[model samples]
Target: MVCDALDLDNEEAEEEMYKLTRSFVNPHRNFEIPTTNQVFKMETGKNDVSLFPGQIVTVQIMPEVIQVSKKAIPVHIPISSPIRIILHPMFHQMTYSKAVQYLKDKSNGSYVVKPTPKGFGYIAITYIVEKDKAGVSVGLRLEVEGCKYIYSDLGELIVQYVEPKARRAEDLMAHAKFKSSVENLNSLEMNPNHSSYGFCFDYEMP
Candidate 1:
């Protein structure tokens, strides 16, 4: 029964059957990054890169270690398999190379395309948005394949720092200003002409 299903009698038939079966399953599963100190470490302390808006950065993949032998010798390997670039909630149905080119053209180079090395010779690239309000670099934050990590350029592990406590004062001031403005606006008598207009934020709406 096994031979009939796998077609052991004919090598050509077996190859065809394998391909047919593979079509049903996704070839590229999601890849995640390792973050433990025992598993990885950052290679550099330099954590800032000035990336402009609409700029696309293409990063090369680095080789990574998979396992350590009983003799305490680490085994390193180069990535050989293909990778898929994740865009939205779902993974794109294309290779990383094609996806990178497609995104570069689609966004007119408004995205950062930096591929980092995951352990075991698997590399995954992450997309970063460089906006005016979000330009603070806290190392390379990756959340691909439902995994997150902060790593150096060489793919070693690192820690991600939260926004400084100093920003709290500025945040409080901004909130106070917004509250004051709303309170002052609420005290104003509604202009009958302006209230009759189709303004979406009309405070005179009963």
Candidate 2:
């Protein structure tokens, strides 16, 4: 008797699910998803460093060994995750320590420094002057060998990890527009030669 009652309950439940799905697909129904003209926005109350063309913004050297397969696409690893520990026959144990140390020694606090992971050292500076936005943009050119510099006409370069502090209504809207543009560039497939349209550094996926 209990088994029969359970079967009857299951059938009723399935019928209820089917009705719910049909209601969702009905064109006359309305959903509650919010719509926005804006796409991305910088965190409020952060400071901004005004950089200009030909200006240099120096940073500390940090290196990580990225693995590349047959096609040469960089194998991405999360920044929070520990690097893979490996042991090769020739070298009993291997870690990224050696690579990091090498770069640090080479940099030695130099303003003109090469980017780690090798061959990602070119810099591109751009000025954004759109009607809706205005700012200076800085980026790294990742598609060539050796070190080189280029100029662009894009808007401000907003680093995702950094906090931005611009409270003016115009600034907020412009920043939001700039953020969306950067995201669109970052979404493209890796192109070392002319990838200056987006961010040069790899980021940890949340």
Best by lDDT: 1
lDDT of 2 by residue, 98-157 (tens): 423333433221111112332233232111122222112233432212323232311221
TM, every model: 0.17, 0.12
lDDT of 1 by residue, 56-170 (tens): 2212223454686667667798887565453443233444555455455432112233333333233343232211111122233433223543454322221121222224323
Minimum summed lDDT over a 10-residue window in model 1 is located at 128-137
Q: What is the number of backbone collisions in each predicted candidate, taken in the order shown?
A: 2, 7
Candidate 2 clashing pairs? Answer: 46-164, 46-165, 128-154, 128-155, 142-192, 143-192, 143-193
Model 2 misplacement above 4 A = 1-94, 107-198
Task: Assess each prediction's global lDDT (C-alpha) against the native.
Answer: 0.33, 0.29
